[model samples]
Target: MAIDDSLATGQRSLGDPAHDYPLWPPLTSGCPRTSTEDVSYPVEVDYAYDKADPAALFSPVRARGGLERWAPLLPPLPAPGLGEGATPLVEIEPGVYVKDESRNPTWSHKDRLNRCTTSAAVGVGAPGIAVASSGNHGASAAAYAARAGLPCVVFTGPDTPPAVDAFLNAYGAVVLPVPWEARWPLLRLVVERLGLHPVSNLTTTHTGHAYGPEGYKTVAYEIFQDVGVPSAVFVPTGYGELLFGVWKGFEELRRLGLADRVPRVFACESAASGALHRAFAEGAPAAHVTVGASEAYSIASPVSGYRGVLAVRASGGRALLVDDRQLADAQGELARAGLWTELSAAAGLAGLRSLGGQAPEDGPVVCVSTSSGFKDKGMGTHRTAPATPTWEEVERRLRAAGIAG
Candidate 1:
């Protein structure tokens, strides 16, 4: 794949812009200046915005290539993509919308991140790519690495979702189901010894791949194009990469003089581990918490990232925590609205509903549905009993289900 003449200038520390590095050898580790400290900061890709043409960059005409369409604002994408991005903005209610990210090639928003992270692997000439994920991230990494024709090793928990397990194997990825605490260590060793690029977090506080979140920025761009600047964007956040990316994308639009204001970006997390919310409560840049049992497995992250704090604080947004009951209710609501989302993915809507009637009323609100319900754990375990074919049985079943005659 040809590299775009991307306007990406360099990488900078999120904590301090004084510490800058070249775009090559993307700092998989957190910012070197702060890594040894208690809280390490993540690095972000910088673009030469002064040189970018707002007209050409924000053109309404749909482009063919995947994230490459926003190449000017993105890091150089050297790897081939699997048609990620350009997800639908579904209007489930009058002034509310759902950015259904399941429409992506891999049926999750992680497709957007992996497309760029895998490209980083190719650009750096790494032998393969590695990730530590519960489900969606690993599946996405495998698909993109396969598309790039590179080997992939996914480090997952022992109880990997059946659907995601199938996805990993279908992509021919080497799946390693290790203890949750051991996956990151194994991933670091793979990167150091095997020369595989990592697409997931390595730091104690979750400073993920520099290029990964850049891919997520496209969600904001698409939202801007579809409905202008929304009043708020609620994101189902784990490490906060997606929340940060959405905030950065809108900030970029405002910087380029394309939009007047950026929206309040909400980070919605599972109450089982509301890392971001906890961090905010303690006035910390990042924090870690003991993860409890939660059916919303994807967003029940034990650690929160500094990137998420930056996004929420900068956008004047709030981090809301939703419990399993709230998650299930939101999931049921989405299903009723004709959108099937993972229990974790419904965190966004769950957060919105937690606000009662206090949701922002200035403009439209968007709850980003991060993945499909098919990716949920124990998805294939349900067995539907066969019903009798008799008219009496059918009518009785219909009546039991509250169906009218």
Candidate 2:
């Protein structure tokens, strides 16, 4: 098949693609969150999705405030609406703000990761993109692949939600529902044999794509621009890419003289799988542990990332373990604040609440809410008693639920 010329490539290129998406100048510093080794590299930029010729996310106008100001015209972001970045840093409570990332293209922070990583595929001339995820990551991958006009293949656990399945199908993705155990091998086969760019964490370890985190850095950029540096950032923990990306983004800003100090980042995870926590506590680079204590199952990974550990240590950050009860409370609290987020998404808020007011009170604090309640689907759907009532009865129920009659 004569694939489209806009595919991402295997080699790291400073070269432009069929469409020249803007990019920052070459990185001059080592990993912002790690002194151990390289985080990842040769990330690509897919087609820019901004409705205008240059989106404000990557525009010098916006960058003047963030590190993007340092590399004005740094590759323009392909942020095509649906609230890609620059999410409102709302101060729902005194001294605390939510950098609600549930507003992204796929309704989660994963969109940022794919935006940068999938661009790598187009930059290197890869024909398609592949991901192994049961949730937000797969949806985000499909969205980006569709935007770039490249084929997308998703390998996810069979338990993947119906909404997620429908989304992939709607986006023209080749969805392959497989057993969780087989995801890794399948991802490798697809990328190696099919020449597809992978936006997944492979290696049955912390080995992740360099490009994915590039997109994620935009969160830190937005936070710095909107709220300045907080004492800490609490990230919903998973493969640790998001945690590291936020840390790196701030560190880069400081390096470029964009900001003053890096925040003490926190990886908020469900107590079920405390791989990252266990690793940090064990004084090991990484660790593997099985867990089953929370519905924040989206982040229940057995593997701990050496890079994740490095991030926590370098930033003087901490990892906090949360439970399902705490996550449910956080989700409820967010609803009260008019932000409906998924269990995994609310995990950050849960971690913060768990920490009480112990976090430094001087600077602005932001919690990245990663996904939406719809992504969880389980919460949005209910088998409640049928509302098959007369009009008056229905009105009574509506009023009871606080809906205006």
Candidate 3:
């Protein structure tokens, strides 16, 4: 399928919109004018919203071919795709739904971001792609890079999940397991010395690729299409790209006069490293915290980004932190509801449950489940002992388990 031409005008700094730059060579280092030693800001793509036609862009009969359908509102998409968008919105309770993103090509929401980031790499005519990730991001980047026929280098922590490690190898990516703090620096070296395009964050505070989150905005568009504008959206936030993207998508709807208002967006983070939460509490644009032990490895981010702060603040929402216990409980709840998600992906539901009686009463609320349970650490380590083949033993075991035949 032929990808549609992008209507993206240019790029603008999230910290200072007055400082604009060309669409090519995305400001990966962020706005040089507004970024500082303490905190760094990310850049966002500017689309020709006034020129967009609601009837054509939001047509119910639009063919489904991933992010390409929304090309006019997205950055240049030169790279090929694996059908990344069009996830399902499953209702788990009355007026409460879960945006199941694990159905994507890589079984994670990062597929949406990588599809755009990889396209940026292709658009810029870079040699290859490099990234620093814990699991999902690396796997998604590797898949996209391979699809684009570009060499990929993945810098991951020594504790990288087995499933993700296998994914990197399967995609023919050069995998380097280093110390947690060394990933970003190594990624920078790969970009500078090797001339490979970086699809991950390279800054001190996490201003990821300019085109990455633009891919994520499709999540909101799909949600809006499935079930009008939700009252609120809870997202599993690490660097806050997904949260900001979802909020921006809805904001665009309202801006285009399609929707009356934008939903309140919430950031759900692991309490072990509540960088966004601390940033909000301290009234800072971004902040860094010493990360503690947490089972929700995917969302246990140590730093907050300006994009997330902007999304929450502009939407009049708050950043909420959930402990590992709450995350596990949420995971169990989802599994019982027939949706097995990564522990970190459950943070959205965990955050909402944290609200208890204070949950939103206006309209339907959505909790975005970012990845599948298969992406979790130590996913297949446990081995269940085989039961005895004898009928007596099976009957006894079944009876003990309340499954008598």
Candidate 4:
């Protein structure tokens, strides 16, 4: 397929017998139809690296900045940015690293996604952007929309954390609290009637925005640059956009003769409602599971997408599920290690623990921590009592607490 020599040419579907389409606005919903019933899976940008300069394509300039660092592989970013990428890769333990995405401008990994999706809104000349989110996605989208000087509307659930709602409102986004089932329909209306660009799932199986995950690919690029290809990468998966993006980034690196081996990717999900795990177990293309109550609401997806399956299967990885108890333990462990993350964000570490003995012998495993602990709904649930400022009382309390040797 002929493509633009500089940047991207078009998009290609991940459906059976993949098809291609031109690069343009409203391109995601218009990707080549895959099923007889008119269902469309996700589409990825196609870059003509063969025609372009490979040396300049993977130049040192990529080591700086956010999504712009890898602009050659991303869509046209007409929107302003907030320095969303370049997160730290800290070694939490021996042979294990944590990609701390909480350092992003919005204090979550969703900023990377919004950078591209909001740009699509600008590229299409849309007046505003909309998303169906209660947490990171909503906050990140609102920030990016504000950065781009565009209006934003968020279809949030009733149980959304007050802090998240506050941040969204602070960004000047229209926060609409609706029923879970009604969010998508309302988002559709916001997109169709008001001509707003949507950055969330519009399809049945989560064919997310065409340009959104392309921004996620920068995570993989950053990881590869920081410490080379890891032995494995454990990711907290909801719709699996980040999982697929990281895999695609490494895949691109290998295709470009940069890396010889791609890390074994793992889709770490909530056991209470692991749709991807269920799908993998049942040998189905995609599957739906009745979501149960869980603290990891951000990663509890009722319906999963084929993009996740593609990432795991393509990268010789597996899908693992962890319960709330495990997630809590992992959260504590991360905090002990000086990295506080949201309950859902600790799923990667929980999944990594689940593979204790069976972990790859190559070592150097990387786990992606998605968000900050402040976003946790159960945060500050514990109470602390203040003591009087007296040396006698202090010594007694310290002795009782075993701190006064």
Q: Report lDDT per candidate.
A: 0.90, 0.70, 0.91, 0.85
Give stretches of model 2 more than 4 Å off: 1-83, 357-359, 377-380, 383-405
* Alpha-carbon deviation at 394 in model 2, angstroms: 6.1
Over the stretch 105-179, how does candidate 3's per-residue lDDT look in tens digits? 999999999999999899889999999999999999999999999999999999998888998999999999999
Tens-digit lDDT track for model 2 on 1-405? Answer: 112322222222221223232333211121222323422222233332222222333334452222223122123333222235656677878878888877776788887767655656776767988888888988888887888888999998877878878888888999999988899898888877988888786654575665566667778877876767788998999878888778877876676555778999999988999889998888876677887755676888878665577678889989899888999999998999999888889988889999883446577678889988887747536877887669887888889999955
- Candidate 2 lowest-lDDT run of ten: 64-73
- How do all models score by TM-score? 0.98, 0.79, 0.97, 0.94
Model 1 alpha-carbon drift over 4 Å, by segment: 357-359
How far is 224's C-alpha from truth in model 4 (Å)?
Answer: 0.7
Most lDDT-accurate candidate: 3
lDDT of 3 at 165: 94
lDDT tens readout by residue for model 1, 1-405: 357568888899998889999999888887898665578799999988999998987888866548988888898889988878888899887888999999999899999899889888888899999898889999999999988899999999998987889889999999999998899899999988988999988887889998899999999999998999999999999999999999999999999999999999999999899999999999999998999999988988888989999999999999998999999999999999999999999999999999872446699999999999999997999997888999988888899889947
Better of 3 and 4 by lDDT: 3
Write the candidate numbers in order of decreasing TM-score: 1, 3, 4, 2
Candidate 3: C-alpha RMSD to true structure equals 1.5
Weakest ten-residue segment in model 1 by summed lDDT: 352-361
The number of the candidate with the highest TM-score is: 1
lDDT of 4 by residue, 68-161 (tens): 6667777777777888899999998778889999999999999998888887888788989889997999999999999889999999999998
Error of 4 at 148 (Å): 0.5
